[model samples]
Target: MATDLRTSELKEPVDVAEYLFRRLREVGVRSIHGLPGDYNLVALDYISKNGLKWVGNANELNAGYAADGYARVKGISALVTTFGVGELSAVNAIAGAYSEYVPVVHIVGYPSTISQRNGMLLHHTLGNGDFRVFSNISREISCAVAMLNDAHEAATLIDDAIRKCYLLSRPVYISLPTDIVQKKVEGERLKTPIDLNFPPNDAEKEDYVVSVVLKYLQSAKNPVILVDACAIRHRALNEVHKLVEKSGIPTFVAPMGKGAINETLPNYGGVYAGDGSNTGVRERVESADLVLSIGAIKSDFNTAGFTYQVSQLNTIDFHSSYVRVKYSEYPGVRMNGVLRKVTAQMGQLSIQAGPTPNNEIPQEELLSPEPTITQAWFWPRLGQWLQPEDIVITETGTANFGSWETRFPRDVTAISQVLWGSIGYATGSCQGAALAAKDLAAEAGADQVPRRTILFTGDGSFQLTAQEVGTMLRNGLNPIIFVICNEGYTIERYIHGWDADYNDVQPWDYKAVPAALGGRPDQLATYVVKSRQQTEELFMDREFVDPKCKKLRFVEIYMDRDDAPKVLKMTAEAAARTNAKLE
Candidate 1:
């Protein structure tokens, strides 16, 4: 059955670089962070020619942090750099993203096939000679890795790698050989959009686990639910709230899971940690007979370095699909649906609620009678400036303390890569979140309307990815950035105080850096405040919030670096004494 087929003229082949650029565009990635190099020249040229915005960083670590910040706001982030050195420098940030379950796409350019085959001393290559040094580094952290040796596999691999990352909520690496970046391919481009479906539930196992959990809940006089980072990262807040409501059980959130439940809720006890530990909340948790831990990873930082034991209590551990009951059985199931179903069933079994009466600190016991320049002063003032829909990103040191104290509005969102406790993640993440907020506003038909995106970063952290200010100006992102100028790594200084001089950094004119980076003077404003009045006056000013201004604002606060936040200092000192007692 050989019928004569009508032959059509073939179309011109598309440039491989252009094809890659278009694919990234289709995936909604508008910004890329990294330093340019010879190996990535072709892609860089195409990206610039096609009007894509590329953000250059001071170092690869900062680049990855910037991408992480961007992803926190934008839903996904991309980082592009030359192979080996660039990729290696960015590893820490990417690993932080992995630990926090943030989605990021990392692209690295490799040496051409000819260069790799010949034992040439390539730039940035170690003695191993193989240009695939990234594969080894990325194996443990990245959700998946795709190396493009053949031009035919480039498009498919890139698409697949991106899809896998989004699906798994982790970083994915794609290694593009220089030769493949230039080779043209003929085909319809891969256009598969990522699917973000929740992992499937195991009904039978879920039912069995639910029965066991119900028994413990019924038997225990006091039962509390401890929510951690995974709960918020997985967008399981609504489900968790349902579980809490149905069980009529008191709830306490981990520091990383601060805002998972409405802090204003009647059942909300407060945060549970050593120093930041709400005494009333801890009493409830400590007295509990059953503790249902949902999406809680037993990290040293979260569990007070495993100093708090859960072995004695009737605890049910819930992971992605597997669940284990202490002194009982381990069952595996889809947690999302299982949790929902169990909550619904438990709603029928009535349990008395624990005491969550609002507990306020006595004025006499407060840090100081007169408000001084401290995180406590800054937090409440900062809270007053927040509106619904505003996004708050905090760094590890002072920002973490601020996160503990600051209350979020229902419309507001808060984010930080706290699991890894990486210092410089917030500044870069703020840039990305600001960019994402714009897109999100536009998608919701709120484009052209003013939106607020705020970042709280330590002096040490702000320095890591400070160069992103240029990208913010170039993209016209208006975010209020507050550099907590304590003058050093306050968190570390409190913990170790080893070589205090080394911990201290010479203070810079925080306001001047943005101006030097080409930010419009009118749109880009900086302020240094030493008093609460100054902080309030600057933030409450009508001109600063003018919708028409569309400016990027910077505020710096000068405080005593040696005088750590009261609660944090107390905790650190207590921890030191505890360690001493153990020794």
Candidate 2:
């Protein structure tokens, strides 16, 4: 076989692989994160030849997560791997990015067309021969999926996927067949600009919808605006702030949308779930006459399992689809644009009332409770120990409960890979965030200040990625790791309707794991707290505040599986309902 090595110079022909690589680069993808295999050799060659950095990961899940972390810091990230097993491993992380509204481009190489059609059992082939395996897996998780079987169409399809990811701010999958990468096509200058223009709304319908929402806003005595992750993912933070400021409406953020508006704002009611759900915030959300839900997905976790009733007559839900005013609807525009337009039309409304109701219990009342081993009572005292600028990373299982029960000061940062709903994301993410925080503080000349990174992982999740603790120890990064010792996947138990046996996990002495992983016990302290009082005492202990401690610290808090928070109970119920509906 004569190879056309100099085809570009001789015939002005474009190599399909080169075209795909160029498209990725044009979209500002700085690096490709994934594990390479024989199935993706051609694509890997192109990536290497194009001078793009390929970050090899231990597994596809971590690769997807690392890409997600990069996207969180930068704007867009890319990941590439082989078919089937590789793609499946990454599904959790990709799904998480989708839920969180992070833009990521996932490239998966497929078996050649001939092999796919001839029924030749490829190395990674499952029962199915179709190379579109990733397409089905990504259907619900990604904003879009494109498979490039034709070399000629590869440029346009690749570009389209990238553009969609950027515009939708969600993960998109692009599948490349092995043969397509080896083919050649005529080179043409590609037009790669994104069309930012949104489809116009029916003017009359929009005006009517706007009028109805305005009327409800004007009439309600205690209208509250609840912003969620969608709003933040759509970059509507400033617009949401404006809406809250102008309407004089008390504003609350769903757990995922925390930090959208500065918690210090006077109208800021506090976070609705997770560590922000102090008593007053919950009451305000439950009692509001009119609830304006901007970019809120009524997910079970965020809505406390749908236990609280929303006044549909006065509830206006603005989703990615349309402006839903009570019962009437308008064509959906981009989220941030729609919110900005609505707030702009409302003109200048003043802050309607006094500071948002303080819902915190008195210290005396909290202390009066006889100390017991439980998450509910332990969370409140833990909140007092958190300081501003400290970032909290929670694993999916415990995060669902901790986010609802724990209350932190307004300035604290809470982070979780919620959308992907992966169990083991916290440990790796904490390492990434901690590294970033350290760099940020150093650049700002605040290197002397102590930076705290906290991870709240369920026992199940902690076991999967516990190896990262050694990374922290080697790097001399001190992060407080609190393991919720329920002895299994609590979230799964909830999902399975308290089928404890299947949900029950093998218990490990988490505090001992760190010590076994070459972490120093003196600098790396471990404690087991069975009661809220013990938790409080540990947090208030002066030893934790010592600046000299530069080793990983572990804390294990024991709680009965049945004693999970009300929000978790509700979430599990809703999941059951959803499953029942599906069945």
Worst 10 residues of 1 by lDDT: 3-12
Best by TM-score: 1
How does candidate 1 score on lDDT? Answer: 0.72
Per-residue C-alpha lDDT of model 1 across residues 1-583, encoded as one tens digit per residue? 5532221221445656777667666667777778787888777877866656777676788788878777766667788888888888889989999988878888888888788888578778986677665687898899989887776667677777887776666899988778878775543554445445665666667778778777776777767788877776665667888887656678877777765776656677766764455546666677677787877866545554444545544687665656767766454464676677777777444345654523333344355655457665666556556665677888876677656655555546677765698877887777777777776666568546645888888888888778877778877888888888887888777777745787877788888989988887776878888876687688778867654458898888777676555556655555566666754
Residue lDDT tens for model 2, 1-583? 7765545443456777787777776666646778787778878988868867565666788677767755654457788888888989888888888878888898888888788778677777776666556588798988888888776566667777887887788999988888888777655644535453445566666666667777777667777888887776665667777777666688877867764665656777766753235456766776777888888765656655555566677788877667777786666544455566678787544334433533354475466766666555555556656776677777876555655455566556667765456778887666545554554455467556546778788888887777767656655668888888877887777778466576777878777987787877655888898876677677777767554456667888888766666566656767777878953
How far residue 65's Cα lies from its native spot in candidate 2, in Å, is 4.7
* Candidate lDDT (C-alpha), each: 0.72, 0.70
Model 2 CA lDDT for position 151: 67
Best by lDDT: 1
| Counted clashes in each candidate structure | 4, 9
Looking at model 1, residue 486 earns an lDDT score of 81
